[model samples]
Target chain A: MRFLKECKADATADLVYRVCPMHLLEPRELIKDLKQGQVLEILTDYDGALEDIPAWCAKNGQEFLGVGEDEEEDFYKLYIRKLH
Target chain B: MKRVYLDHAAATPVRREVLEAMLPYFSEFYGNPAAVYDLGAEIKEVLEEQRTQVARLIGARREEIVFTSSGAEANNLAIKGAALANQKKGRHLIVSAIEHHSVLNAARYLEKFHDFEVTFLPVDQYGLVDPQRLQKFLTPATVLVSIQHGSNEIGTIQNLAELAVVCRTQGVLFHTDAVATVGQVPVEVQTLPVDLLSLSGPALGAPKGVGALYFRDKLRLVPQIHGGIQENGRRGGTENVPAIVGLGQAAALVQGELDAKARHLSRLRDLLVAGLQERVPQVLYTGHPVQRLPGHASFCVEGIEGEALLFMLSRQGIYANTGSACASKALKTSPVLTALGIAPDVAQGSVVFTLSQDNQEDDVHYLLEQLPPAVERLRSFSPVWRKKMAAVAGA
Candidate 1:
């Protein structure tokens, strides 16, 4: 898994306490609103998102920008750059 | 026997317009809102429309409303949901002592299992939570405060704006259970300054089993009911389309009629209060005289039990409540009355009358006529009444 010191995104989808598939479903919907090359951040507490999001990015042809460190350590902040 | 129903706070008859609006959804439009097909898409649109209607009634954005099973569930979501999600900020919570059992119990659950400290805030004799007193309870660890907008049992409306502002200035979240106030009065969140609010469909002439919570935009809540992506992942379960449609229709109808309805209800309420005071001795009017719900009148009659008074009044074809329907059946002194510092004996006689638009002036007159004699008859059989009379005679 790639890690980044700092990353900025055009939009953020906060799915911190929401259930599993929502970690996948909401970002797919939210990323549609972003233009190519703009980064989208997904905040989630679900551990599975660490692997699923990276794989989903590869399958969907989007660039995975790696996870950014959160100071509180409560949730993961994963970033993706829309490639299409 | 003349029948008069004065228990709107316990339940209300669904309005005709609301029932009609809900009929088609039960069969013809019975499609899951989560499916990918056109049928599901159509049902999804209908659900969002209802969300919009419920949101507009409270001056909140459509996205801010999350539908739930009942007002109790909404309270659970607002209290437990918000608190759990924000626990990192603090493990402390505060709620008024006179809140509905739903709010009180939810807080207790957190304190018992989640290692949180909860403060059961006290209220004045009139059931008013003083804003200054609330401010003093705030700590750096305080995360949320839940106070009901109006009391279904006592007819008192909290000065929510003042209380909410205290929390706001301190950067703490504030929630109000508005089940008793939503359709009865104008409750625009834009002016109220609360972060969360709960409202029930039954209180506004919609069918029971449907309610909604309003959380400010971007507020995070841990889901109380775990399931798939329903209610935008805030609450889960197949949408109750028929009841939600009913709630929407009732909300729209009440929004237009609220002013006239409040005026009609208050007129009857004043008549009943005046008549009851004139004909009955040793009656104590409960809650605030002017700051209460417009259609609610509550009293404690000395020398009689409210349950027995209810039975006698029921025989006369009048339906009323001694307190909240749940607490009244327990046959114990109401915690609400006890919190207000009423003597246990006096609180035993607590009676509440909640009026709705359907009730007419004649209904109030009938209750006034039947209630005094009902109390008198109940007191005549009571040893307590004799003791009070003997003390009066000695004096």
Candidate 2:
């Protein structure tokens, strides 16, 4: 798992407390709105997203930009760059 | 005998237009909204259209509304969902003391199992939560505040915008249970800065099982019901298509006729209030006289139990309630009236009359004609009334 000190994203999908499969489904829909090569941040509390997101990104040909660290927030902030 | 129903707060007859709109969805257009086939896809579009209609009634975006089984469910979702989701920020929550059981119980549930601290904010004599007092209770640990927009028992409407602003400026989430106000008055989310609001379908002349919660855009709520991706995975289980359709139709119908309906109901309400006040001795009008629902009037008649009065009225084909339907059968003084500083004995006499557009002036006249004699009969049999009258005569 790659970690980043600070990463900027073009858009963010906040799936913090929304139930599972939503962690996967919403990002797919939201990333469609982002232009190619633009970064999208996904916020989720579901632990499964940590693995599913990166694996899904690899399968879908999107670039997994690694997770950002935020001590203040309880949820994980995973970043991805849309690669078309 | 003319049958008079002045308990719209308890329930209302589903409007004809709403029923007509809902019937097709149950039989002909019945399709699982989550299914991928043409039947399901078409129903999905219909569901979204209902979302849009419900949203339009409250000046909200279509995506912000989530249909629930009832207003109680919506209240649970708002209080528990928002609180659990934002627990990382704080563990403290605030709700008015006179809030519905759904909210009060949800807050209590959080406190009991989730280790969250809840403050039941006090209200004034008129059941109005004071904004200044609300601000005093806020701490950095306070994450959310739930206050009902109107009191179903007392007919008092809170100064929600002012109360909501205090929470907003303090960075705390504000939620209002608008089940009592949504259809009876104009409740535009654009004007009120609440993060969440709950409204009922029965309040809008729709079937009882339907309600909706409106959350401000991008507000995160932890799913209260766990399952597949229904309600965008916010709430699980297949959607109740027909009820949602009914709520939407009712919302649309009410929105078009709101102002006129308010005028009509309030006119009948005033007549009832005036007639009761003039005819009945020692009748205490409850709640704020002016800052109330357009069609609600509540009173407490001294030396008579509300239950006995209801029995008498029901015999005369006049129907009403003693505060809440759930609590009335418990034969206890209403906590709402007690919170307003009413004595327990007086609170036992609490009677609420909620009007709808369907209620006519003749209905009010019928109530006026029957109520005085009923109160007189009950008072005549009461030792308390005799003692009070004897004391007055001696004085």
Candidate 3:
């Protein structure tokens, strides 16, 4: 919540796509609408996605802004700057 | 990140020697063994030789070995095949509660499809099957008794010889899914008194897609896959020549270095277990301390999910398994751990560290150094830990 609201306020990144460990395929589809250089934030509880999202972003020519591992919430916030 | 593999029970990297032995079969000797050509005849002879080597590993005759695609398929053949073949003698079967899914599902299939009765015998807190309990279930109609030689999750090695004797005395066929124990420990078919034993090649440093089923000469099993007279008409299919060659090499290597590898694995396992106990005080050992597999060190850490622990460990390049590999993906507590009489909450935290001779003591040290912090970090986020702490504070 608070993070989603913060994501909305930033003109560069307008929305946040949420994902979990069970549904991993959603991230690619979620980021499809965004134009080049538009930032996207992903909130996920899947530990694998923390490493995977960055690698995927790099492979696809997107900028990976690194992850915020919320140790308290046991979740992660991954920011990617999409470059088509 | 520096990587360490601690999940040998699940799978292992193919050994170099095994791979080398397999290469020629894949390319040069690519002819089908069933064909009448000279190349095919040569390949067939090689396959028979490989069968002999695999048979030698467990003290079984080459003719008794049936090459299968996996341990699961081998288990299916043993359980269903035996059940179907012996239906006239008995319509009832018995299995231990903690058998792998292959055996359990095969028994269920028999019960559902062929109108057979199944009895699942319970295990003790240490996951040991009581022979007396097994005796209570055995009757004149009991056709077969299926149990695992060693549990993949809890590492509990059953008193299989005793259990096998009980089955033999009652004229019931005995089968053990020795997938987890065959290469890791000594499993002599000649002395074990079991009618059938399932083995996985991948579990023994060979390639995947190859396994073997050892059936006693006198015991009859209906062919599950009927067509060609392959595997002495017990299992039908084109032989996986490369994998079979690899399996043969792997089995021979394991048999030769059995004692040394067992000792090495035991030492590594003990060090890891002792280190974890010393570092993480709340951890509970889940398996039989002495009777378990030499390479297996399993535990249930208090107040943390096994997957979360595995994730954190994976980040540090230390990979481990939670529950049995077959059931780990489901996010359910292991039935094997539950069979050990553990609480549901504790059972959810189960982690198994299966070592092989390939792993060094330094890997265990690396794991011990990193594991406590991972557990602590995960426990901090766990609601169960908070609840327990709150109760403690209130008290």
* Model 2 residue pairs with clashes: none
Clashing pairs in 1: none
Which candidate, 1 or 3, has the higher DockQ?
A: 1
Instruction: Give the CAPRI class of candidate 2.
Output: high
Segments of candidate 2 deviating more than 4 angstroms: none
Candidate 2 whole-model C-alpha lDDT, 0 to 1: 0.93
**How does model 1 score by TM-score?**
0.99
Scored against the true structure, residue B39 in model 1 reaches a CA lDDT of: 99
> Model 1, stretches more than 4 Å misplaced?
none
**Chain A vs. true chain A, TM-score per candidate?**
0.96, 0.97, 0.65
State how far residue B134 of model 2 sits from its true place (Å).
0.8
- Residue B99 lDDT (model 2): 94
Number of the top candidate by TM-score?
1
Q: What DockQ does each candidate score versus the true complex, computed on alpha carbons?
A: 0.79, 0.85, 0.01
Quote each prediction's TM-score.
0.99, 0.98, 0.81
User: For candidate 3, lDDT tens digit of each residue in B1-395?
Assistant: 77999998888899999999999887888999978999999999999998999999999998789899999999999999888877877799999889899999999999999999999889998889988899999989999999999988888899999999988888889999999998888899878889999999987899989999998974667767866656644567799999999999999888888889889989999999899999996799998988999999999998999988999999999999997886889999898888888999988898989898889989999999999999998988899999988998999
Model 1 C-alpha lDDT per residue in residues B1-395, reported as the tens digit of each score: 78899998998999998998999998899999999999999999999999999998999999999999999999999999999999989999999999999999999999999999999999999999999999999999999999999999999999999999999999999999999999999999978899999999999999999999999988999999999889988888998999999998888889988899999999999999999999999999999999989999999999999999899888999999999999999999999999999999999999999998889988988888888878888899889989999999999
Candidate 1: true contacts recovered, fraction: 0.65
